[model samples]
Target chain A: MTRFGRMWVMTGLLLGLAMPAGPARAQEHAPAAAAQAGGHEIDIQHHIGDSHEIEIPFVGIYELPRFAPIHVGGLVIDLSPTKHLVFMLLSALIVALVFVLSARSIAGAQARGRPATGFAGAMEATTLWIRQEVILPTIGPHGDKFVPYLLTLFFFILAMNLFGLVPGGATATGNITVTAALAIIAFLVIEVTGMRTLGPKGYLGTIFYRPHGLPGGPGGAVLKVVLLAVLTPIELIGKLAKPFALAVRLFANMTSGHVLVLALIGLTFLFQSYTVGLGASVLATGVLLLELFVAFLQAYVFTLLTSVFIGLMREAH
Target chain B: MVHALMLALQEEHTSGPLTVEGGLMLWTVFIFILLLLVLKRFAWPAILGAVEAREQALEQQLAEAERSRTEAAALLAEHKRLVADAKGQAHGIIVDARQLAEKERAAAMEKTKQEQQEFLARARREIDVERDRAIADLRREAVDLSLAAASKLIGERVGTDTDRKLVMDYLATLDGGR
Candidate 1:
């Protein structure tokens, strides 16, 4: 290991040794400290997971507005907003506001025959880069129509991912339901694009597993049936697996990073030692930086994969 | 179907990491759809269209510039050719003028030489005619004087055709002998 790596390992070992020894002394303080530790333990999960309350920094936790469950026949569904839902709305609002303002600024600049400036310039560059690099290249030439949808997905997910790093914000993208919904949209777009590009007969070719150049006899007919029977289920699974992977990958990556950061901070309270708290703070800060990187990475991966899947479906063999 | 989906959602919502809140999904779908519609309508066209238009304008300007450059090159070549043609025409004019001047000078010299030769020939012919006339006159006068003197010496009128014939015959014999 390099010097920095060795030093980090040594510091980790020292913290590991001191953490267990410090808790014994922490027990000498009071029962109230133990109660606080239990509270911190519970807070870690609630902090990363979706809940009914929003925790504002320097403000007490506030319960979200509750609504009566919708009932249809024998079914009851809770439609009240939760913490993640509130943040999701915030992300959407931010995305809409920024893009709209950028649109205006860009339009004005274009009218004046000048280039875009300031935040508007940055937004334009990002939009162009995403369209030219991510969407058009992966989704091919006809992907122009899909630019707005994919751009929205990229920015919205990115906004949600970054919001999770804020002191009192929740990551909507970390939720399975949220990722799954986005995935479902992507799945629909991909499949529908395939259906439209390849007519009904052509689209069926993807699922039916018809091979070219089969023999010209009864043996060929029997072989064709056997191949269809064997390959159809596999083709169906392949189609479904794309969206499933997109949803689970985004959800897992976003959630895991938050869990690690929360768990690290929770350790400071659990040990009840100033040294452990300091160590945990440093470690948590590092992990938070990694989480920040993960946020953008996950967003890009989700968008790229979605575009690739759409392209693949459009050009299915 | 609604009951079954609700049951599954409820079960997952209370469960561990794979919690599926139906409300969150509904909210996501609602927000995404709305955002897509609004942004697509208000934002994408203006921004994307402007950029594409700017790119097209740049390409057109570049093409026009290239065309003008090519036209200028062709015009320059034509101008150079015209200059060279004018220079060649001027050279041809000078050569023709020199040749005409040389021909005229040679013709004038030939005409002057011919005139001098003709004058010399005429002068020689006139001189010969004058000499012949003077000789004839001298001969006639000699004959007349000889006849007069003979007639005076003889103291007789012998001035007739016979005396002229005798003198003419004597002159012919003298010319033949000389």
Candidate 2:
């Protein structure tokens, strides 16, 4: 094998060997926690879902701080931080710090008539790629104005998704609530752009589509009514469906990868065999690698789909 | 493996993965908006501006390079033209000098030939005049000696103008008869 191939195999082997250790450690306290919860069954939900507790491998699980529920007129809002919420916050903070610093370095270098080097260079390249290749092309002309928003989404989601792969880390992007919020924002941007680009009368055409070259007078009127009656609801559904797809696609993809990895890791404990543990570890390693890819992929997909939706809205006839 | 995955997926849950926590959603919206605003203000403009400035600088540099290359080429062409002109002028100067030298040589040769001819003609004229004078002197002496010899033979004085004229006439007749 070539050097890179050999190195790759070595990494896979190491990852495989290291995979079972975390689950094994957690398994030490699994029975006690399961018993306390009134069951002795494995709860995959505890791994993928939000929790009041945060687990860090090699260190014990710690309960997050709880805040009092805020009362509105008839609604109670619990702003208490959960495991996913904490990870989300961490992802946001990390993105902010890294980008702010990278930007400073880039600007400093540029002022001296040079391109940024090192970590800032890498960050610049990535941001430029997303801006030039993904956002600019997908969202068409005048798309540069939206680069900051889309770039933030991509990096933030990417960080959240990648955090899941870390030992004892949570996947905040896997939560439907988070994905839904992102999708809602994307939907607002798309519709608002459509309204701004097309104005009131033109914007209405997207939902109440009327085909050209229809008969004049009464027949055209009847045809227009018929078209509106049939296609308007479909068009409205399509508009809602775009954001819905964006939300569900990201949530499911991010969640499924973790679920598979969790299930594979669970296999070792279920069988209680060293041979099985090794096999399960190898499998989990493969799934973990795939999860890593999915992390980047889902981020890219979310950004790409949002841009595409915006483009569609911008030019809607 | 599929059965295992299905069994795992079928496992019971307290709160399903699909459930959207309202507070979490609120937090996500707040965080996403905040991040967008922060990054937009601090990061995106600076990074993008820097990149664009760099691109413009590179483009300007490339254009300048092209202009410099064109200028160099033009300068090279002009230098070649000047060298060619200088070479042509030098050749013209050399050709003119040779032609002038040939004309001077021809003129000098003609002058020398004329001077030699004039000297020979003058010498010939002087020789002819000298010969004529000498002949006249010899004739006069011969006539005087003849006169003296005749007087001795006759035993009479014949040295006079009249005698000379008669003798000269006789001599002329005698010469005519011969």
In TM-score terms, candidate 1 sits at 0.74
TM-score of chain B of each: 0.58, 0.65
TM-score of each: 0.74, 0.77
User: Could you report the DockQ of all the candidates, in the order they appear?
Assistant: 0.27, 0.40
Q: Is the docking of candidate 1 incorrect, acceptable, medium or high quality?
A: acceptable
> In candidate 1, which residue pairs clash?
none
DockQ metric, candidate 1: 0.27
Give every candidate's TM-score on chain A.
0.86, 0.89
lDDT string for model 2 (B110-139, tens) is 999999999888888888888767655655
lDDT of 1 by residue, A1-317 (tens): 24522443444445334432112112222133335443334233444568787766435568988899888677666789888889999999999999999999999999999889999999999999999999999998788998999999999999999888765677889889999999999999998999999999889988887778999799999999999999999999998999999999999998887666545544655565557766765776667677788889998999999999989888899
TM-score of chain A of 1: 0.86
Interface RMSD after interface superposition, each candidate: 7.1, 2.2
Pairs of residues at least 3 apart in sequence or in different chains that clash in candidate 2: none
